[model samples]
Target: MKHLSPKQKASIALAALRGEKISKLSSDYQVHPNQIGKWKKLAEEELAVLFTDKRKKENHSQERIIDELYQTIGRREVEISWLKKNSSLSYPERLTLANKEHPDISTLRQAELLDISRSSIYYQPTVNPGDIQIMNSIDKIFTQCPFYGHRRIKPELKEEYGINIGKKRIISLMKEMGLNAIYPRPKLNLSSSDKQHKKFPYLLKGLPIIRPNQVWGTDITYIKLKKYFAYLVAILDWYSRYVVAWKLSPTLENIFCIQALEQALKINKTEVHNSDQGAQYTSLNYINILEESEIRISMDGRGRCMDNIFTERLWRTVKYENIYLNEYADIGEAGQGLSEYFKFYNEKRRHQSLDYKTPAQIYFAKY
Candidate 1:
């Protein structure tokens, strides 16, 4: 009784499945016909499972990564919540806790994770009480009308709130507050003209988005908190206007943007992904994720906000509906509030553009 190798057994089994006569396989392999038949039956029983096992492995890996991320998020949330709860400690005091020599996280990330701006870490200028009032007014105005720039806001400030503030002051304050007007700017591509970051052209032009996963538009917007602001990045399905995934970060770092994209991929992949020419969207790591997913990359042209219009609309909706109304006390509050708001936005809020159907309804209609 000569022992057969696994490779030889597989070869014999393949031949059997290919319709070769069992007697011929047994003769070619110099094995008993019954042994050949057993191998063929085993292969037949396990062949389908081979492919299934591969998929299960991939899914398990993905699930493990997602679980790790959730754990990190939960731990980070606890730390941030503790910091926020201690109102006696100023942001400057919190900034001092960032260790420069930290191995895992950088100082910049530490500042962001602590919900303090990097610039504020170095220079904690005493802000005037009046300036805060003016900034709050500006936030309100910007939330309602994102297209309003300093020039437009100056007049609105005088007219709406009757706050007679100088244009230079408004400009400086808006810059410090990171409240840039959302409008088209010509030659914006030249800003990203550096060799490192490459920009893609708008691919959604004249293309109809007819299904849930046909196109996904993503963008980052500022969410106003009581003391500071956080950035919100979201990926939305263009056809159903469903928010696939969203992340709130205290900083404008590309990591949050990449996280949102990765989370959305875990839900479902899109044929084409559209985004603005912001550094977050054009960053190498962010672009690599989309490219690895085989998604067609589409970028807004020269500060054309309308190219990723659906995401822009999503920001406006989120702000007006949930953000401005509450004016979240801190990042901890903002995160919890946004979690609920997004659930409502997806599951309850009806959109007229969707023929008065909720985003969840339209998104899951095919399923």
Candidate 2:
């Protein structure tokens, strides 16, 4: 009949848990026998809650540790990619590093981290003389008429250069050159949608570009070299026609595309960023970056080359004004030459469409 403190009840319950007789515990604590049983039961329940709370805390700690480890891995991978892109590490050294033992990462992942082609690790480069002429012809025809697909390009080759080549060869060469006809085609409905890559509807249609960074377009083009050729990926601000950033890579590898995108984002964030439905743009890494910044991702619908007309025009301007006029001995030479020309194009060259104002002028000063 006496009121007991929680501490007394808990002490009685613990004594019961320790295998002391319930009657003796009740007598010792001067509590009712039934109340002793109740205290013991309550104590048992509380003990379970305590362990449940401990497990939850343990799980949270484990999750935090896992997240930190993943962050560390991500940082390491980013560092490795930066070194591969900017550092003067030789291919063999990169290969060695990629192949090095890492508990959390695999060789394939490490190769991706290094931006080195896994096959190129052992394969040596040899010049195929026959491709030189054909590729050169393809480059010219594509530049003159970008909308020319392999089907149309085949005929142009025969009529213009009198070189009759099969459609399959043209297709193969175009694929190797990473050339896609700049025009709309029927969308192939996939059986299952890729959750990782979300294909966005073309958002630029009927959208007027009244200011800079309203819609920035990016594209890739073939940069011809004497012995070997490389691809150039560039980011162009649509309204101002400003070449925000550009990167040259020896292959149509997606890494360069990502690098250019990151560089452009760093300099200026656009409201609606447009790119052709290239794998590079649709990549999860690329999409996440844009989405995280709250920028809209717009893809040029197939065959809607005009959707990215400014970027297409930029390629023409770059090639006619600089690439063709200057013969590049190597990738380094091409990068250097294009670097200077882009500087001139952005800083000096006047655009009739821009009301005779330069891209830099319009972008920086006007709008």
Candidate 3:
């Protein structure tokens, strides 16, 4: 039999799916008609598995049976080995016996059967020397000077530690680390220049927010981890500082932000929902969701810090109290920390603006 690379197999499969004649496809693709015919036959056989639900049903049953069998064997083998010998079996001998009983089983499958992650099988201490040093410095500086921007931080690094670096590089690293200055008010970051999307004005400037649903604020913030970063979007009750909904994503894509808004709307529809003029918030898809919920749309004025003060404060509290205090090694850790902090912030932490009451207390106490 002639061997074909994956690329050749893919082309043949695609041509077969398109219903191209074998002779013409072979001529165009520069392969023999016999080879094309064999490829088409293989594709037709596999294509049924792709579209048909039978394979999935059979696989499900097979998985359950395999799991039960493996568990039963594992439990019995330990007792059998103890009873058969006064001394324990060697490592290789134990492995050999296990493999003989389950010829098709894999280590990964065994781990899954035991309800453990593959990473737990081979544990290693993780220590990134460079990232640890950078993270330590960032935590110290962020704690000491919460209001210092990247421009100020760059100069401080040079003067204090003699580590000369430019503002752009420092800013990029800060963004990656999810560190930003806690301005007295919100400073719009990375506002969109796309003219295709219509921009809304800051509607709550003079409007009095007396009730819980009168005005809602939304914003996206960066969540940093040792390995990667995630974006968080939250809908907040502007009047009460109560969080309605929130979501985290591995990218700055608009889908997660939209999902958070959708979840918030499901709970209760607000009269107005406000956000900064970032592309994710300003995209037609995002605005349509709010408009469809019959909620009026409002946006922050460009470069104005006071436009979204409530949400800005939320970000400040999250960074200072939770994120900066711990080293999040991954998204899961960051998410867990945020979950705990938001609960405390909404249910326990007293705010001076709310007359020394928590957000949830103020939001519900009024209504």
Ranking by TM-score: 2, 1, 3
Q: Cα lDDT for residue 33, model 3?
A: 66
> Where does candidate 3 stray beyond 4 Å?
1-150, 159-162, 174-189
Residue 161, model 1, lDDT: 96
Model 3 agreement with the true structure over 1-367: per-residue lDDT tens digits? 3355786577666776788655434423445667777777887887787667876777768878799899979966764554355224321122223331345454434432332222333433253555445544654565466567877777777777667767776766665544556553333244443567899888887898888888998877666566544567788998889998887655554656765776787878899888777777886667766776788988877655358778867876777788778878765566667777889989999999988988999778842
Model 2 stretches with alpha carbons more than 4 Å out: 1-127, 186-196
User: Following a full C-alpha superposition, what root-mean-square deviation does model 2 have from the true structure?
Assistant: 18.7
The CA lDDT at 303 in model 1 is 48
Residue-level error in angstroms, candidate 2, position 233: 0.6
Clashes of each: 0, 3, 0
Higher-scoring candidate on lDDT, 1 or 3:
1
Write one digit per residue (lDDT tens) for candidate 2, span 63-131: 787999999899787666656554554333454445445566554445545555544344333657677
Weakest 10 consecutive residues of candidate 2 by summed lDDT: 186-195
TM-score head-to-head 1 vs 3, winner: 1
Better of 2 and 3 by lDDT: 2
Q: What TM-score does candidate 3 get on C-alpha atoms?
A: 0.58
